[model samples]
Target: MLLATSNHLGHDIRSEKYNVRGTKYRTKHFLEFCIFLFFIYEIEDNLIQNTR
Candidate 1:
């Protein structure tokens, strides 16, 4: 019985670790996308200013 419980606990810990990693991966991608958008905005602003 104890062995079974330990096995279950191990599974839970592994899943939790995976969840944390997944969140980090998602956050990194999101930040990268935000940076890309900001870069585009800056380029557009510069173009508009040059045209003015």
Candidate 2:
């Protein structure tokens, strides 16, 4: 889910950046991406613990 969310967020960032509106959407997309990345890291940590 994290990977999928990252892909979606990347597409949103690209679309928002190219839009004629402004940087508002771009900033939102970037923040969302960061949050998703953190989620991915947490999942990885859990997986590592389970493997031990």
Root-mean-square deviation (CA) per prediction: 0.9, 17.1
Alpha-carbon runs more than 4 Å astray in model 1: none
TM-score of every model?
Answer: 0.88, 0.57
Model-by-model lDDT, in order? 1.00, 0.91
Q: What's the CA error at residue 15 for candidate 1, in Å?
A: 0.5
Q: What is the lDDT of residue 35 in candidate 1?
A: 100
- For residues 1-52, what per-residue lDDT tens digits would candidate 1 score against the true structure? 9999999999999999999999999999999999999999999999999999
lDDT score for residue 31 of model 1: 100
Evaluated against the true structure, the overall lDDT of model 1 is 1.00
Clashes of each: 0, 0
Q: Determine which window of 10 residues in candidate 2 has minimal summed lDDT.
A: 16-25
